[model samples]
Target: MQREPYRLVHSVSSKFREMNHKIGLFGGIFQYAWNNRKVVKNEDDETIFVLVVKRYTTKHEPWNYIRPYEILRKCEK
Candidate 1:
């Protein structure tokens, strides 16, 4: 038997134009195309991958001056 590697990905609205945005599709078993979305990039390497979100939220509401990471961490717990 063979096994395939697994990866984790997360995004709200895609910043790249080539990637189509599937709004409100952030749970599981569904994906849309994305491009050039990585912390580090190599020249001539334009690869795309699937993105999965552990948790998601809408920023429509105002926060009490708290950072986003802090809020995400609290939500994870």
Candidate 2:
């Protein structure tokens, strides 16, 4: 079976949004925790998207921080 590709639905952080703008529409990586994901479904019982937290490790930043994200597959019709 084939799997669909992921697309960014929303970003809870301004920093993340800025990063996405810099990356443009063509190609770039958006890091997130696979273990921290929450699945979101539509009324039709199909999975519309997944809600996940941003995954990052900073050498200079503090120990605790969280950023939420919504992602889904951009299906081609």
Candidate 3:
């Protein structure tokens, strides 16, 4: 049987995006789309695969943070 992808959620600061861009860690060039929630990218000519689950913006709230989830891996049933 097919497995389900792992999911994780956490609250993060808004500066995460700026830091990523400055460091060029997760801000990789688009390589291709894997599925609905997964994508492959190239960072410095190296393959980088990422699976994003969900994203939420708290701009209008009393916080300067965002909640994003990632699917790290899949497990067999």
Which model, 2 or 3, shows the larger lDDT?
A: 2
What TM-score, computed on C-alpha atoms, does each candidate reach? 0.17, 0.18, 0.17
Candidate 2 or 1, higher lDDT: 2
Q: For residues 1-77, what per-residue lDDT tens digits would candidate 3 score against the true structure?
A: 48754443332344555544432322221222222323434433222332311111121222221122122122221
Q: In candidate 1, which residue ranges exceed 4 Å CA deviation?
A: 1-12, 15-66
Ranking by TM-score: 2, 3, 1
lDDT of 2 by residue, 1-77 (tens): 37654544453466667644433221122233323335635322122112211212232223132221222223321
* Clash pairs detected, candidate 2: none
Q: Which candidate comes out best when scored by lDDT?
A: 2
Worst 10 residues of 1 by lDDT: 21-30
lDDT of 1 by residue, 1-77 (tens): 37644432333333321122222233111233333344555522223212322222242222222244234424643
Residue 41, candidate 2: C-alpha displacement in angstroms:
46
Q: State the C-alpha lDDT per candidate.
A: 0.30, 0.30, 0.28
